[model samples]
Each structure stands twice: as C-alpha cells, then as structure tokens.
Target: MNIEELASILRNNYTNADKGNKVSAIHAFGVQYANEIKENNYLATEIIKKSGLNESYSTELSKGIKLYDYMKNMSTDVENDTEHELLSKLPWCEIAAIAMYKNDKNYKYTPTEVKNLPLVVLAKKIKKAESPSIGTELRECSNDMTTDYHRKTRNLFIRENDLYYLSENGIKYVEENFSYMISDDIDMPLNQILYGPPGTGKTYFLGKIKNQIMEYNKKVFAKKQSVKENIMDLSWSEIIALGMYKANKTNSYKPNELYKLEYIKEYIDDKKENGGATPECSLRSDLMRNSIKCDALSESGKTGNDYFEYEISKKVYKLSQNGIDMVENALSKYINPSDKKEINEDDFCKFITFHQSYSYEDFIIGIRPDTDYDGGLKFKEKRGIFKIICDDALNNPDYKYLITIDEINRGNISKIFGELITLIEANKRWGNEEQQKLTLPTGGTLCVPNNLYIVGTMNTADKSLALLDVALRRRFEFVPKYPVYDIDGIYYVDFLKKLNETILLKKKKADYLIGHAYFMDKKKQPKLQDILNKKVIPLLMEYFNGDKGCVAEILKAADANIVFKDTFHLEVI
Candidate 1:
C-alpha cells in the first residue's frame, strides 16, 4: 500500500483503540510497514503527520522501525521471534535504546533478560559498551534516551558535555544480572516527617498529596451514576432516612414528620451545589456496597436485617440502631470532608503548626469551662484537634486521614504527646495485634487508628533531627526534603547550587543551605532580584548570625556578591 493508504489505516486503528492500546496500534503499524519505512526515510514522518496523531507518535514510529529492523536482522524466523513479543509491552524509548545497544555492541539479549532489564540498566550497559569518544550523533541519541528515561527510572546516569556516563551506583547496577523485574511499587510511609531547611516545598509536597487524594475521589465518583440519576428518584422519606439531609430552621418540623416535596427538592438542589451526598441516598447506596459490615450488623442484633425500616401509613422511615452506627461510620469514611457542613478540604487533610506554646491539651484533649450552662461556669472535658481527627479515622476505616504538622520540632514532643506517644507507632495503632490504648484523665480511652497517617514538616535550620526527642524520632520515619537545583525554567539555579555547596562546606551541614522555593514567587514562577534582596539575604543573615563577611563569602562562591554589593560591608560578628 502507498503511504496515504497506510496512514489512513493507522489513523483508523488508533481512533478505534482504547487510550492504553493506542501506542501498541502505532507500533504495530510501524512493524507491518518496516520495509517501506526503511526504504523511504521520510515515510514514517509522512504517515504520522497524515494519521493526524499527536507529535509524540513521531518518536514512537521511529522506535518501532528501529526495533523491527533489529529483530528482522537478528532472527531468521523474524515473524515468530521472542523479541517481537516485547514490542507491544515495552515503552517505545526502551525498544529504541535496546536496538541502539545491540547495534553498537553486536550482542544479543534474550527475551527474558530484555523483559527483566529496567531502562536505566540498559542505558548504563549501552554507555559502558560504547567507546569513550562515541560519535556526536550516537552520543546525542543516547543522551536523549537517558534524559527521557533516567528521570522516570532513577538518577543513575550523569550527563557531561551532552554525553551520558553512569554513576557509581549505575556501574554496580549494570554489573548485576537481570534476574528480576524492577518493582513499580512506591514506598509511602504511614508516618513520615519531611525535614528540611525552610522554603524547600515541604508544605507544597503535602498539597500535592491532597490533590492526588482529590483526584482519586473524583475517579471513584465518575464511575457511578450522575447526581440527578441518584437523587431524582429518591422520595423525601428516603432522603430523611439517610440522616444527612436535615430540615432548615426556617422549615417547621414535628416528630417523625416528613419534609414537604418542595422543601426536599430545594434541599437536594442546594446539596448538589454546596455539598453533602446530593440527596444522601447515593451515599447510602455506596455505603451498602463498600463500607457496610453485614456480619457486624447481624451480630449486633437480628440476622438478615436491612439498614432501614419503612412505615407505609406514615410514609416515613426509621433507621435501625445498628444501621445508625453503620451509617455514621460510613459517612465519616465515604463523604469528602468538603461535603460536610462547615467543613472544607482543610478538615480532611488537617494542617496545624507546632510552637513552644502548643500543649497536650491543644493536641489530644483538654478540660475547658462550659459557660453556656444555666448558672455558674462548668468544667467540661474537650477533645483536641488531634483527638477529633483520631475519632473520625477510627470510625472511618475505609478512608485515609492525614494530619500535616508544620514546624514539628518547635514543640516539645514529651509535653505535647504525653502518654499517647507509643500509640502513634505502626505496630501500636488500633487494629494491629500489638495495638494499645491509653486511658485519659476524663476516663475515656484513646488509640491512634491505623487509617490515620501523620505527615509532619520540620525545618532543620531551626533544629536538627538528632536533637529531637528520642521517642518522637523512634516513632516517626524522617524523609529528608532537600533543595532541588535542577528545576526547569528557574534562573539562578547554578548560583543556588554553588551557594548550597559553599554552605555545606562552611557550616558542615545542609541545614543552612538555601531552598529552591526562595527563587519562586507565590505563583511558583521563578523570580530573581526581589527574592535575593528580601528573602535570600535575610535568611543568609540569620544563618551566619549577622556576620556579613561569612554571608559575603558564601555569595562570592556563587558569584552573587554583585546583587548584595551595598549590603555586605565586611562587618565581623
């Protein structure tokens, strides 16, 4: 077939295939038309352009052609070759890298080995096998693959003068056999403290985690029926039976009274706009499907009991005692924090900053006076923010609750956590075999739930981890959040890197190093002089304890002294 016919066929296949299978269809097209593409240098480009696919398809086509040529030249039975089997599964860039490696080294890799090898491993192998002065074109190709793949895989290869070379770990990785496939599992610590110098995007990282949770919830919501479909069919009694939809103060209500049809419709529409379950019947349905514990309900009272009982005469519904408990539990778990009255995203992924004044009562529980009572002031037991979150987390076993503590090291851990310090440990959390609970002064018991994750940020510039309470250190995993210098579109990256290097050399610690956040504005776009004058200089002053000479020395290392020409007057501390 001519180029136009092939392109049309490719376009049809691409359009018909699902999102995930589209790349494979493109590869298949290239494989089938490999000879034609090889003969005509511009055939792949022409076909890709005519196919009306994304620009990314051009790279995929090149990769597929290279892979096909390599397989056909290496194998007598090219159509049935094992290497051909991997063409669909592996990334286009990976296939191209393998082809390049085979061409340079004249060494054939088994399908098993090829399947097991990570992109970084192959890139490392290619770099090692090739000559030191490999031609500019080949080196550039290798560099492109390394740049594309290395960032996705791991930081193994270092680039120098547009050439890729393996680091110490990369060398070791290449020497190892491809016995096992690299795992795709990302390690998410249940209790992690991201400790770093200030402005290193610690809270920004927490925001990212919150966004991911929101996206996950959106996906879960997308698969279900539309809001109108779920709400439009439900009666006023059924909506009230869910217990989330309540009559406003303006609307009169008697005992066991069903809301008027107009009032119910208004409430449902308001819920759809603001929050709640958009009729709450959909939420009940979801709970019944995912969160309801049938066995637990059966054990609690009667077997084979539905969550709600309906009275035909009154046209009203009553929730079972066990069902009330189950619905309360499910509501906390399934409903987004934003859905609840007077609650927002902050209520879901709670954020709190710790300071010297922050106390155990403020964190867990405390006694406060109740002035609202009739006569004199009364002392009452009140749960703190942490305790409130813990209660919700305990109730909602299906959902994950996050409490992000900013400036964690500023507070006294022993004073703040009190006896509940041991409860935060992974093994000691509720539902674990070694789970432990502490009795409060108010006679209530408290345990940190398993579903609750505590992520804290500590500025090392204020206090180092070694100096933190041993009990706190032992219970939490510390993940270092250092300044990243290689951010795209950020000017003065080289200056920041040099400044950090000098700080490490002089201070003998990374704590005093400047963070990348300093160079960015509120919009996260890079800013230059204003940040240097206002934020960066002031921070340097604090680090050096107002010693202008030391601050000047560090800035000079980065050739940034020109910005602070008037500020540094060589005043020794």
Candidate 2:
C-alpha cells in the first residue's frame, strides 16, 4: 500500500495495535521518512521496528547481502540426504518433529512420538524452539486452522482434550477489535452515562467499571511501590521511623531533615496521586510539609516563612506546634479507626444520589460547625466527597477515581453541579490551560482532576432523553444498554423478543419495552412461568393502563394469556 493509504488505515484502526506499537506507529507517521516506506519490505521493517525487533537487518538486501546464497549452500549440503525428499510431503507438525530429532538437542523422539506429545508441552516447545523458521510456520498454520471457514467447512480439530487452543486469527481479532474486548486494554470513557430501561444492567455495568478501576488501582499501587523502592535514597518507612524517634526526644525536629522528608513526601504524593490517605491526613501532611519548606527557605534567605499564618478568635498563630497537635488529634479519629479491622475496596468508592436538594456544597465542599474538644461548636471548613477524591487523585496520578451516580436524571443538574458543570469537561479539568478553580463555601479551592471518572446511570423509561438538562446531557456520552434476548439456555428468548415487539408497537416507544433481565433468575437462568405471572403481566397492565382489550391482544400475539382478577391485578392465564 502507498504511504497515504497506509496512514489512513492506521488512523482508522490505531486502537488495534498494542500500546507500544500504537505509539511507535504514530511517531513514525509524524516523521518525514514515513512517505519513503511504501514497499512491503520497508513497511515490514517499520512494523518490525515498532514490535521491538532490530531495524538494521531490513536493509540487508540493499547492503549487497544475497538472500538466496545461504539457502543454496544449505541445499547443496543436504542434497544427498534421502530424508529431505521424504519429509517434504509431510505436514509442518511432522516435519518439525523430524527436524527436532535430527538436530538432537540432548533429546530425541520419533516422528510418531513427537506427534503424540501433550498439546500444552508441544505448543510451548513449538513457540520457544531455537529454530524460528520451523516454529513460526507451524504456529501460523495452527492459528489459521481456527478460522470459521476451516473449523466448519473443513471440520478440522487439532484436538487438545477439552482445552481451546489460542489461534493466530483469534489473537488478531482481539488486537484489531480491542476496544470492544472484555479486557483492561480499552480506555474508560471519561464521562459516560449508561441509559436504558430498568433491569437492563445499567447499574450492574457501573459495578463492572468500578471493579476494573479497582484492579487498575492495585496495579498502579504495585508499580509505584516497585519504583519507589528501586529509585528512592531514603524510603517513606524509614523516614517515618526516624521522624517518630526524633519527635520522642524533643518536640523540635531538625529543619534541614524535615525539608528533605517533605521533598520526599511530594514525590510519594506524585506517585500515588494521594489516593489511599484520608482527606484530613493529606491536609495535615501538606500543611506540615509546607511549614517545613517555608522555614528552610527562610533560613537560606530565599523567602519568608509567611505561608503558615492562621487566626482563631482574632489571635494569629504561625503553623506551629498547636496547629500540628490539632491535626494529629483530628487524624487520630480515622487512623486505626476500625480498631485494626481490615478496610475493604468498598470503603474507597463513593456512590452519590443526585436529587433536587443536592447542592454544590454537599457534592464538593461545605462549612459546618465543629464540636470543640471541651464543648461548643467551632466554625470549620469541611471537605466533601468530591474534594476527598480529588485529593486522592492528586496523590495517585496513575490510579483512577470513579464516582457512579444512580438515577442521575432525578436531580436538578444546574443547581447541584453549579459552576462544576464546566470543570467536569475533559479540556477544563486540572492541568489544562482552560482549567478552573473555585474557592468552596468552606475554604479551599476545588478543581476536578483528570483521573477522576464519572459514570452515571439513567432510566430513560422514567424520563425521556428529551427531558434531560441540555447542559448536563452535553457533558456525558450516553451508551445505550439494550435487553439481551438470545441468552443461552433461555427458552423464553423468542417469547421475550415477540413481547418486546408487541410492546414497541402498542406503546409507540422503545423505552417501555420489557427488559430481558426481568425474566432472569438468581442464577441468571431464564424463568419463563415465574416472569410471565409475577413480573411481565403486572408491567404490561401498567404500560397499557388496564386496557384489558389491548393487553389481551398483545399477550395473544405472543401465544400467552393474561386474566384480569377481582383485585384489578392482571395474572397469567
């Protein structure tokens, strides 16, 4: 293909390649040399280079190296061998067996013996064999055999007991269509709303995203821990021990040492995005770190230590021992708060229900009176869930923060989100030039972090998409979740399909159609009679509004019957 054609193909299917390949391909296209590599050899060279192979070998032909010289010499060496002629007709698998035994790599096996080798063992050896030419050819054949044409028409089964062998075609399919794969390779949508009728697994899909984020978080933690251990001169654990030991001797800590520790804390914060630590702990840590930094800079005559001034009841105080003690006391409530009980994943995730009364203060930040240590309430600025998540995101840049709002349309969007409606935009988030920050009703400035992901579920049947707030709707990309009628082992798939057709015809809308989830039992198996009697009939009655004639006609079309009882409830007949 020409460079222009190739570039177009890549642009359309960039997500198909692995991450490194995708990046390299993009970089190659960006450079001036891309247009010169229109031939297959040069194109293959680019692909090979992107795949982490050496690029120099691609120019061997142009460098006066004869490709057929080595082959001709090898052909002459093996020309008199009778086995070569006999082995030519055999399949690659059998030929591979004969070659392995002939090479005699500390072990020997007859062709029959090698052919009968366990599939797992054979597959591993075939892929890892020292002879790349034989191994690569056999692997290609194995993968090509799994194609639908080969599997159905040729009825070819390279049986490996009950195990399904991975095919080259299968791998290619996953790599090409990776965005739709059931894998973590796909990027999570920044602002996605899964909308559908009730029981269509909208909320359940949110849980899936949460679980994916949780897994991603764990990986980020592990990677950060590894990098921290490998790169840091003094680790956090050792710093904590030294700090505590010094504190025990006297209230006064060394200035220079504290500055170094504070610098290290910044590194940790950058690595973690401040995720696992509580909001109050992060605040206290930041304040203390800043105080130390200020004192250090002041002594060096670079800057003044004026950053820590605070006033309470008209009395000004520096970021001193009193403030530190206050933070420690407040943090004590959350530290080992569960009396050494292990915290679970659920503790970190927040689920907020947005309603008409839900305000910006409630969602982001607020001011509430704090109870004094002795008595009475003190005016205190409180951090809300969003702020806490933002702090966490700031500390842990690699990890994602997910906020799932159920029934998002039930709330007054303009009122609840307020100024945040713009900040939530991908381009307006923190680190972007268009980023926004607002001083909360409490105190601190708040901005939505880039790592924070918002997943909301909306029941379109309850409120049509047209009724949603236009500003709120524009911020989120909606993904429709339709009912699955072709669930395996479900006998009512045809019945539900017919019923949904009737519903759309009668109700004049798709949202009111019955969802497949209603008929699914606890084990996720279909329960036909139970669904028909308890759920389907009752729902249909409400949809038709007790129009018995219309309901009866709908049921009759689906080869089912419903009867109106004395209690005015419809029952399966």
Who wins the lDDT comparison? Answer: 1
Candidate 2 lDDT: 0.52
lDDT of each: 0.59, 0.52
Top candidate (TM-score):
1
lDDT of 1: 0.59
The superposed Cα distance between candidate 2 and the true structure at residue 519, in angstroms, equals 2.3
Model 2 lDDT, residue 220, Cα: 42
- Candidate 2 to truth, TM: 0.50
Residue 319 lDDT (model 1)? 60
What C-alpha root-mean-square deviation, in Å, does candidate 2 show against the real structure? 21.7
Which pairs clash in model 1? none
Per-residue CA lDDT of candidate 2, range 302-339, in tens? Answer: 22322233343433224345334533553333122223
| Clashing residue pairs for model 2 | 272-395, 272-396, 273-394, 273-395, 273-396, 273-397, 274-395, 274-396
